[model samples]
Target: MKVKFYATFREMVGRKEVEVHGVKTVGELIDYLAEHYSPDIKRELLETPRVGPNKPIDGMILVNGHNVLHLKGLDTELKEEDEVHIFPPAGGG
Candidate 1:
């Protein structure tokens, strides 16, 4: 699975795309990424300070142009060739 970070997330992660191995659900991917990155990213990605591995985020996570929320939220299963996009809330007027 290919995970793509955007905007501030990309800046924080320092990479646009990351290829993960043996990841089944979006929740697992999030846990893996948070463990790899700095504390800042871990906090930003997690819903609460003491939340579990599958905590949901207020932001949006897209799987192949489709919102993960519509599929199965954090439990959304990913397959090879699938593109997962994480985006922060957009604010404009």
Candidate 2:
């Protein structure tokens, strides 16, 4: 899968894009990257609004040009060729 990070996230991973393999869900994907980056990923993308300690994040997560909110949230399944774009919170829009 092709994962792209926006805003400061690009700096977080030190690259705008990365390729991840063997992740079946968005949650799995996030966990993979967060391990390499920071736990703040869980805080910023998954832990915001405090839905629950283990609840999925409702941040702006897009898979293949469609929002995961309309799909299955973080449980949304992924394919080998899917494009995952993560857009962090923005200011001055």
Candidate 3:
């Protein structure tokens, strides 16, 4: 699957996009990414006080322009051509 990182997430991963194999679901993919990147990324992406240490924030992951929450949550299935975008919430006033 092709996973794309945007904004602060891109900086955190040090890459705009990455091709990973054996990723079937959103949750599985997130787990893989957290394990592959630096400890800082793992901490920031995975360690949320609200969701505990394993659940990533719902608003952080967008699957093909649609938030995973509206889809199948973390179990959202992904295909080879599907685009998964990871981004932090944007805020400006």
The Cα local distance difference test for each model comes to 0.78, 0.82, 0.74
The superposed Cα distance between candidate 2 and the true structure at residue 79, in angstroms, equals 0.7
Off by over 4 Å in 3: 50-58
What digit string (tens of lDDT, one per residue) describes model 3 on residues 19-75? 988889887888788889645544555565645434446237777888886788778
Tell me the deviation in Å of residue 57 in model 1.
2.3
Candidate 1: C-alpha lDDT: 0.78
**Separate clash counts for every candidate:** 0, 0, 0
Model 1, residue 65: C-alpha shift (Å): 1.1
TM-score of each: 0.79, 0.84, 0.76
- Models ranked on TM-score: 2, 1, 3
Which 10 consecutive residues of model 1 have the lowest summed lDDT?
A: 47-56
Q: What does candidate 1's lDDT look like per residue over 4-32, in tens digits?
A: 88888888789998888888888888888
Candidate 2 lDDT trough over 10 residues, lowest sum: 50-59
lDDT sort, best first: 2, 1, 3
TM-score of 3: 0.76
Q: lDDT tens digits, residues 1-93, model 2? A: 999988877777888899999999998988999997766666688766744544456457899999887899888999999999998755565
Q: Which RMSD does model 3 reach against the true structure?
A: 3.1
